[model samples]
Target: MTDVAFDAHDGIGAGGTADVRRRMRDELRQWAILAVGSLAIAGVFAFMLAVSRLPGIERVLPWPTGFFAKGLVIHVVFSLVVWFLTTFALLASIATLNATEEGPRLASLGATGAHLVALAFPFLLAPAFFNDSVASLNNYVPVIVHRSYYLGLLLFGLGIALPAVRLLANVGARRLQDFGHLALAMSAGAVIYIIALTCIALALSLSWGSEPGRTFHEHLFWGGGHVLQFLYALLMLTGWFVLLRSSLGETSFDADVFRLAIVLLAAFTLPAVFFYKVFEPFSPLQTEAFRRLQFVVALPSLIIAVGGLSGVLAARRRGPLPWHDPGFLALVLSPIVFGAGGIMGLMITGSDTRTPAHYHGTIAGVNLALMGLFLVHCLPALGRSVPPSRTVRAQILLFGFGQLVACLGLFWAGGYGAPRKMPAGAAHLVDGAVIGMYLHGVGALFAVIGGVLFVSTVARALLRQQPAAPGINSAAGSLTQIKGRRGGR
Candidate 1:
């Protein structure tokens, strides 16, 4: 059990004292509970998705089709939206500790409670309410229109927003230039996302009487959903930069470039808010305007991505890298899938299978980066060491390849005009296009398996307590070296 010295420049460095380390460990471990819990549930829903799509598999199960649909919506909202937000909050809480040496204990606990409630809500009520209550399968924020669901969302949003606002305001109060650009960017993005959701909730309340059911939910979440994409992109890029820097063993990219990227991402997101708030809150015009703006939101990520790759290459020229590093391998594979997603996106015309192809690849890319960061950084921070396992090394590849195959199948079927979200075993063209559907199904199954494995590995790592490495964890390493040099002199 050794201590890893915290570097001030790393943006998340807390004090190297044992007590501070213990506190940080406790905070991260609590966060891990929520993260692992959400992910595990996410994995279950993912597996169920396969069953729901695999024709006979779903019917033999105890649940009905509507139940699966309802659960799927709940799963998506919690897994994709809530899980990411909570993780961002965890990051923010850490940065807050590093920057100010104070923990957002109340905020973190409140958010954890909210997440648990949200995660448990559908399971508790879905079976009984599936037929009576409508599952508004909106693009985002899909939840059954139950009072309990709404309450859970309210609690969740407030839980995240309050702390995020505190963090952003705290950072702004201090000299912003002193903090790492990625941390600042992530905090700002979190705040903006919460604010955007708040405004959307308000707008939805106002327009609730006019539109009904899923239509209202659609209008409610459309503008906010578009804005959320920016938040996701920011976090994804933040993960990319952090993991890339860690893999290279240096924070090689310029802080200013990272700052500018964050600034540009924030700047691009503002237009959507203006369009929604100042012009019209819930309208097709607002949706269209925001939709168009979503195109360039990834500009910041692209800039940083290219810059990061260049920096890594430059660093490689200086010395040989640990090519077998699992984290580095995950980082290397991320952008490839992301690029595949982007390319697949260009082929999307109207409602077709390619839509899922584009998103699955893109989302999988982000998930991969986050997973790498968790394994290489978060676990270490939590006083847990990643076990050296070949299966651990292969998780990312399996997931990435699964996504690639799935997307390719989607693109193939889409080329033949197969519609998106079509039920399994439904009527389809009796041609080569059918093979594409088969590939889609098969790929989806593998993706689920990979996803389960990834989740299981993370859970295992988190649960298995390990002593931190001495040279890796202790501030004494550098101090002793300095003392040794002085004694030599």
Candidate 2:
């Protein structure tokens, strides 16, 4: 493998003239604000969710019959669906920053899409307040079985899909390799997202039953939902690169190896469309195929993670680590959390708290990476640097630690046969399970605090008006300066 010199300005394929870069940076900032705002809004619903789950608190709160379920649906859509997709749009915008012909046009479209998502967001939450709303806590993208809720979801999907399609069309195949690993990963993730949308469309047309309830929605989102996980995983991996680059001053893995991992991740997703062709949408075989696909596709991530660990160790031997840097903390914690989730996934024997445990761990891992990326890399690159603060570092640690403890608590309670998505009072848990639930509740409280700190800190930085300095055009340039300063000290 050859060593490719890192170009600070063009890193992640952000090649453009000064004016174009400025315009792209402005657009990227909006996407960043949109992404962070989505998480902030999600936090509101998350608090209600945690309150409805804790033991004694549930008895005191006057949640309606379907409130918890409805809130869960909204929380997942905003935090998981909206947050992840909006961040992807930001990244895709970076990759296409150099497309002089389509860049301006796409920028307009992307901004419009971002606004559309924001407009549709309230509708997703509106159903939870209505007494007539029905929550279908389906596997992937859960839904409220109302026309308004459905309309909100449809508009949200369209908002993401429009820019994603434009991104895919703009990224030429011949230029893929030149875009570097991060850009390639972002582009590949776009492809996977588009494919997931396609799978959902096919599932809608080919679904076996006419029932308009949970089972129907479950199968409706099953295949596409499974596929969407790959996109999330890919995005998490892309974030790992950004976090690593910011923390270590360079990527730990070989450039070609990084590219290969991205290609394989995207290439594997192409065959997922065929599963719909071979097996019925509701078939056990189809479900199993999607389940197995996750395991199979995870190999690339395993390779990257192993390589990253080795790199981190080598860097550690050379000098002191960046313990003060939140990016470093996030990079270190992400894999630990994600790997734990993967192990817990293997331990699943039934539909218990273990399922939520697995997902929470994995999702938190991804969230941590994106959080760090946004604060430490994206903000600084766009000329909005979050000043060095204990609050930022504390936020990362608190969230990571809280999530880990929460996952452990859930796993422990699951061992005692505690049901998922039920309040402690309603779960009919054993004494042992109750203890674990208490732990879970406490951990979630701390995690929410940490998440709140992150949101406020980033929100403040985003709100500030900062003049563009030299090298603000390149994401890697800001990271490079951080690395140089750390090395000099």
Candidate 3:
């Protein structure tokens, strides 16, 4: 006699799915906490390098950019490396909780290791001219190519591309649908940008004998730089989609429109962002073409943003929206800040203020949203449940608002003659504006406090071995199914 046993429906159950997702969320919290620490260090370095003078920062630095650019390059070396690590941890943690994609995860892990090594190249190249005698330009200024830096860039580019290839392939040819397509576009765009950067770096290393390697490198760099910026922006949008669906439990407004926007971003955006690379480096004629492309990069983002905002409002169809949920808070803050960034981008051509305005807004605002979403979205899954109370509610409010304002103030100040790192002296600003310095410092301070508190809370939850609330289970999962890792995915 065979005993009849009930199945939990294709190996999934309400509790099991919940259990899996919750565990994944917990891992996100820890991953974010580690990221915060690295970002904080970068921040500290930024304030110090920006506010104070450094040792022999001139003769050795081969670039001629702004203080912010210089400081930021340092920050990127530190921050990107950390981000690479943080990204891997996130992948591992995600795998631990999901346990559904072992082969891809392993490939991603290997690719990440290569990526980290690639990230080290910039660091190796910096000491050549980071001294006071080397150079003093803005942050994001292109450095003259160093051999180590070029090689490092090659490694870095390969690292990013290889993982992307594996992950895209792993999702398999059959699974390419709505989300997969978005991911593919994003990855492809990223590849383009990465290639552009490598070309720029290569150009840097070459001698410009009456020409900068026939201008291909410059155009490539432009393409790469713009695309890098786009990659971040695109990922943030995806993050928004994730927050909305998972956190808010609602379908996005005009989902097809958003997807189309992504496609347009890939198509129209490429030529616009990379036009500079196609020109004569010093030809006066090419200026207009370059400027026009800048407009291209900024316009579509602004247009799409308007559509997204309208769609969001349409979806809500009312005011007095919930301000307490972390996910909602991100939706509130991210788009608004990015919209403001779009406005800044529209204001001028090649002005220092105009250039960095959008950059700061996009980078800082997107990061802001990502952080807030992780809070409300992932904490409970990790067993460190945030109590729904006036305090947490207030934390959510002050945290998001304070950060938005702080990032804006900082970026605006940077745009408004608040030069980047070690600004000769605040007293010697573009118009001798004392107010600029004060505003920048204040903004940085506020942002720091907000970031610290945010991380502390997540860290507390991450350290907890048991669920924060009573009804949670602590079952373990595989980190990688192919290995002896605890939670195999």
Candidate 4:
């Protein structure tokens, strides 16, 4: 692995004949990401926000599915595509910082291209055109989409190819001896997630309509929900990098531990190997066996969370570290919250109480971690230092905590047979159910406030800034200097 540095301007290369291809690849990657994001946002505006699950089909889809499709397309797109793109770019930045690793560089480029295709075609078009392409049982867009949708998915898959290369190509942060471990584990886990989902997608296509494919139909999308929970967890693992970096500076993460966790994440795929047909009203043997496998898939993941969190906390230098700021505090709280959710899942029996508790915990924590870290990157450009922002971020922290509590309440309510994603809010609650939902709603409001403030800060930063230097260069510098001096108060 040769050292690399981030040169967003010059083009990506070490100044050889390869430089032309490298620059083209690198610049193309950058341009592709921007282009896809632009189009995706437009498509989302045109298609999403209101028309999510297409009403009357409410009973046909899952509780979460309707809301996720309609209201949360933004979150889904950002979570699956934007988050990775940002992370990929960040990795490229790190690779650039390191001054080497053609694979990561290429991965970055490919992801950019993939994102563009995903945005324009499947994501944009499928929702726009396909009535048959339903938001299906597995909480993802199913085989209801048309051929164009498949192409979009294929393009996204192609984009994923780069990350796969990085996992094997071995190039990232030079400071860490095991730079590639986390990347490899995440790649494998993501692959499993995609494959499982793809199988479900394919099964959906073949099983529905005039003829159904029963064997494959029963196998896919049944336990796939739990597997997706693992995917969320897998992503949250990246937060460990921030955890590792901030706490002891750098501990050189345990590669074996990370890999084991990836395996734990993928453990659910093993059940697919047995390939049994299942449906409601199964015989006692099948029900019991299926239940056992479900629990089995969860246990190791539970262990992985425990191990990962414990490793991070114990790995800490043992001094009182910054936890008051929303960003850093969110980092501290993510795994803890996610672990709590996982624990809830471990202690239940299809009662619906524990699983989404774990789901919300893990997913919310992952969101907070990702958003919080990105804020860390983008916030500093505005003028506030990480330490200082922590001091002023009280409202932000309170908002997040409020949201967590509310979500937790919703989880408990769901366990006791309360529904999620209701437009009715507390009105839908019956008897004591209202208590949990009301709490959840109130918490949501605060979470919204915190989120708003975070965005506000970013917006403020991106606005034109007074230059740090003055007229040593030109009249532009003089104007900047004058503006800075005038605003110095």
Best by TM-score: 2
Rank by lDDT (best first): 2, 1, 3, 4
Go through the candidates in order and give the clash count of each. Answer: 7, 0, 41, 14
TM-score computed on alpha carbons, candidate 3: 0.66
Candidate 3 residue-wise lDDT at 338: 66
Return the TM-score for each candidate structure.
0.85, 0.89, 0.66, 0.62
Q: How many Å off is the CA of 275 in candidate 2?
A: 1.1
Q: Report the lDDT tens digits of candidate 2 across residue range 1-489.
A: 111222223333254456655656667777888898888888988778777776677577667667888988888888899999888888776655533232344556776777777778777778887878789988889989887887888888887876676666665664554554444677788889988988898888886556768988988898888888888888888777666655675546565666678888888889888998888767999999988888865798897798788879988998988888888888888888888888899999999999999999999989888887777767765667786578889999999989999999999999999998776577477898988888888888788889999989988888886654443344545533312111221
lDDT of each: 0.66, 0.76, 0.47, 0.46
Candidate 1 residue pairs in clash (backbone atoms < 3 Å): 2-469, 2-470, 3-473, 3-474, 4-472, 4-473, 4-474
In the range 1-489, model 4's lDDT, one tens digit per residue, is: 001111221223323344344443333334333423432453344334444446755565443433443334334544444444444433333233223323234434444544554454445344434444433322432332345544655565455445444443433333332334334445445455555555455445544553322233244444444345455555566555443343333333343454566566576665642433443322455435544554554455555456556655664556655554455566666666656666666665664434556556655666666555444532231122234364336544755576577667777666567754344432345665667666766876676566556544544443435455221111111111111111111
Give the Å error, residue 236, model 2. Answer: 1.1
**Model 3: ten consecutive residues of lowest lDDT:** 1-10
Q: What is the lDDT of residue 404 in candidate 1?
A: 78
Question: In candidate 1, where is summed lDDT lowest over 10 consecutive residues?
Answer: 479-488
- Best model per lDDT: 2
Identify the runs in model 4 with alpha carbons over 4 angstroms from their true place. Answer: 1-112, 115-118, 121-154, 165-179, 190-228, 251-256, 263-318, 324-327, 347-357, 376-399, 420-422, 425-428, 454-489
Residues 126-154, model 1: lDDT tens digits:
54235565577787678676666676676
List the candidates ranked by TM-score, beginning with the highest: 2, 1, 3, 4
lDDT of 3 by residue, 357-460 (tens): 55555565676555654555444434455554554444545545654555455455555555443344443555433454455456556655666666566656
Clashes of 1: 7
